[model samples]
Target: MIQRSTRFGHLLRSFRDAPSSSSSKIGGYLLASTASSPLKQACVSTNRDDEFANLDWDNLGFGMVPTDYMYIMKCSKGESFEHGQLSNFGNIELSPASGVLNYGQGAYEGTKAYKKEDGRLLLFRPDQNAIRLKNSAERMCMPSPSIDQFVDALKQTVLANKRWVPPPGKGSLYIRPLIMGSGEILGLGAAPEYTFLIYVSPVGNYFKEGLAPLNLYVEEEFDRASRGGTGGVKSITNYAPGLKALTRAKNRGFSDVLYLDSTNKKNLEEVSSCNIFVVKGNAISTPATNGTILAGITRKSIIDIARDHGYQVEEGTITVDELIHADEVFCTGTAVGVAPVGSITYQGTRMEFKTGAQTVSQQLYFTLEAIKKGLIEDKKGWIVEIDQ
Candidate 1:
């Protein structure tokens, strides 16, 4: 096995000698060419004999347990991404003045890889994640990798850590792609350099309640995103600020916090980490992405799936009053997947919704899961198969 220190040294040397020639400006930051070195194979072949013996796949939860490899690439002040390599998973050295640390100039994406019964691995709509990351980068004044680069890196990373992928019907490998201004800059503007990295972790469910219905706290005191803020994108800065509200809600025996629009404070926006949807009879609706709510890939897919089931789906404003009175409510995202919301409490008034095996949320969840595990035909072409 390659020593972690040795692999890090090799990575530093490669970055130091990276090329710097052509340049363009995007979002006020210099877009430069990528490093000249060919992409290196960072995934060491694993001995399959002992790979799956130690993992408790059925009991896995959403937490970070290091896997075998991670993908890394860098770009200087005026270059585009040229190459990337898989490296042994370990701690990364960073400057104290790095843009991400000082100014929060970074964005990230979350998607998952599932293991099929036939040993094939699949990714769901990674292209949507790629496009979302680029949009986030642009909003944060940072450079981003192309959709091809992003998808290729994800494939390589998943293959490298194939051993960590949970078995079919168990869990999945959660892939996180982060783009940050790695360049050291003491100023209050964009950084001079950037880094793009992808890492994977095997996870079961994000909420401790698992597939059961969730209890949500309607956050009247805290606003998740303002109208002209970074709420519409997956910027890294957008998450931490909501922790206070989330903590309070969880402490009060709630699954998560439900946020309303920052401006009106009446229109339902979304939950802290997932998008919100309401089902009334045969009609379904979710808050429109009006520059204040993150456009979720799973949310979009659920809309399509609901429509396919002959339900009338609408993307428009939904008030907290409308949400509280809906026949059923649920949340959707990469981490949460599709989770039913059983109840919501606002200013001491609590309301409950129907959630069970027959609800639309459960139906959509099962359909998506079946399609992901290759049990059903992928009619929308959403699944990207990766060769192991």
Candidate 2:
């Protein structure tokens, strides 16, 4: 069990031990709708039939395919999250003048659930995601669920859509949790209400190259995030602004954009979607999380794993000159997992790195994947098994 702050722990305990009338009402509504809807009927039939027999698990890409159900909860302003329910996966009704639409007052998280060979489902570091979401909600002035509530809701969502989970080695279930200011508000301020939702989709590799090395284009024109910004958090606003640069890079046959610090424009901040790491000789270093980079969970785990494997891991400033001359480079994230960097182009200078067999990235990738798939003992207790 994860520990919570005193005030939040007491509040969550009260909310859970004593159900409010509002929760009862929400639960009743979900039950009635799920029992009567045609979509729900189809979902039940599909769950009863063969699950993976219909899905082409090997060919799944990183795209959203509607699952059976999603978890939802709502809260009023200046209140704790009191209730939640699992409902059919569908479009949500939101006001046109919502804060998320107008002012981008929202945050989201990405994590995955893997199915073990023995028919056990496992989650990787969900508590970390819960903490990150709480911090993000605080930044956006939205009410967030407690750590227990958040993890419980995730387990509920995964269990409700267990049929959609891919096979042991084929793929995994991508879980996306979103929190947004949903109340009707036109002025530039926090909305009067908030919505918390969790949805899952079966997905294979995020990049088309699988574990192959990716070609990165150094982006000097636009910055992904500035100092004292929401770059450290998983805000939805931080993604759309990089599409133009991403499109330009993709057109030039690059896989992603590597951004530099906005102020200096010299040190490497991060990749557009993943955290970067460089290995030179026996030393492995990555950019520090200094309010301008998202502190990735996988990055942290790899750092620890590298240290355990007798590699010196340093978290500090990594210059482009050093990166271009490094022995190996790779990126880590929930979606990307661990992918080697084949080459980087900066100022019309293309630098290549060693990839493929017997590299540090390959070693780390296989170790992490084995631990996730239950092929090795989980000494760090990172895997949380969902009850059947």
Identify the candidate with maximal TM-score.
1
1-388: candidate 2 lDDT, tens digit per residue = 2322354334334434542332322211232123222112111232335545378887999999898778777788888775666666766767788888889999999999998878898999999999999888888888898887888788878877777899999999999999999888997899998989999999999998887799999999999999889999999999999999999999999999999999988999889999999999899999999998999999999998999899999999988888767999999999999999999999999999999999999999999998888889999999999886
Structural similarity to truth (TM-score) of each candidate: 0.91, 0.89
RMSD of each predicted structure = 6.0, 7.7
Q: Could you tell me the C-alpha RMSD of candidate 1 in Å?
A: 6.0
Worst 10 residues of 2 by lDDT: 35-44
Off by over 4 Å in 1: 1-7, 15-53
Candidates' C-alpha lDDT: 0.85, 0.84
The total number of steric clashes, by the backbone 3 Å criterion, in model 1 comes to 8
Question: Model 1 — TM-score against the truth?
Answer: 0.91
Candidate 1 residue-wise lDDT, 1-388, digit = tens: 2223655657656544655443332212222444442442233353444445368888999999888778788888668876666666877766788899999999999999998877888999999999999999999988888888888889888887788999888899999999999889997989998999999999999999998899999998889999789999998989999999999999889999999988888999989999999999999999999899999999999999999999999999998888656999999999999999999998798899999978889999999888877889999999999864
Model 2, TM vs. native: 0.89
Model 2 clashing residue pairs (backbone): none
